[model samples]
Target: MEKKKVKNIFVEGPISAAFIGESIAKHSSNTNIGAHSIFLGQVRSDVLGENVVQSIEYTTYADMALEKMAEIREEIFAKHALTCMHIHHSLGIISAGEICLFVFTSSKRRRAAVDACTEVVERIKNELPVWGKEIFADKTHQWKENTL
Candidate 1:
């Protein structure tokens, strides 16, 4: 089988509510989709030592991440009855309470959409080459570790 082209999933800065709303609105035309599941990952303000996280500066080995994501997309398509899926991750800085990652999955069934969306997010966290530098309110920073 011919391999599908890998999509560039990075968005500059934080993902916006407007952008996400538009994405959902665009899918309204797909009448075959009975259910859609979305996962939005946000930057959290967590206290670490004497400082609180203000934002996260995200970076990635894009080529590797996209390649691995393509493999993931193909695998998910094979294993699930999904109608469509979209994944977007932020690069650069995203403030606390802002969206950093968006995963949208749809299928003709609710269970498929829900299960596939969760699995895709987990794989992206574990398998993709994305990194986040947690920047504290006190101007200090720490590299984030994925709890995959």
Candidate 2:
């Protein structure tokens, strides 16, 4: 069987609540899905010395990131009985408390939904070619390091 390619997951600026809501609402017609797991990655304000992070400017090598995400998606589908999955990441500046990443997974069983969502999130953190610049309240910026 032929495999599907992963679509681009980048969204400009911060992801809005309305978009996320609509995404969930659209899944109402999928009767086969019994459970859904969603993960929202929000920017955090971190204090370093006298400066506090106000926002994060995200950048990525889009082509490479998408290819990597596609690999992850295929692996997850093979390993888990997921009905569907969606991944969205933000580009540009996202303020603290704003959503930067949205990962949603649905499955016929709750365990598959939860496990697929968690694994996708972890893989993206470890594998994607995404970078962040932390913009501090003092106007200084520093490169971010992925902790996970």
- How far off is residue 20 in model 1, in Å? 0.9
TM-score of each: 0.96, 0.95
Q: Which runs in model 1 stand beyond 4 Å of their true positions?
A: 1-3
- TM-score of candidate 1 to 2 decimals: 0.96
lDDT of 2 by residue, 20-106 (tens): 999999999999999999999999999998999999999999988998888899999999999999999999999999999999999
**Candidate 1 lDDT, tens digit per residue, 1-117?**
676699999999999999999999999999999999999999999997789999999999998899889999999999999999999999999999999999999999999999999
Give the top-scoring candidate (TM-score). 1
RMSD of 1: 1.3
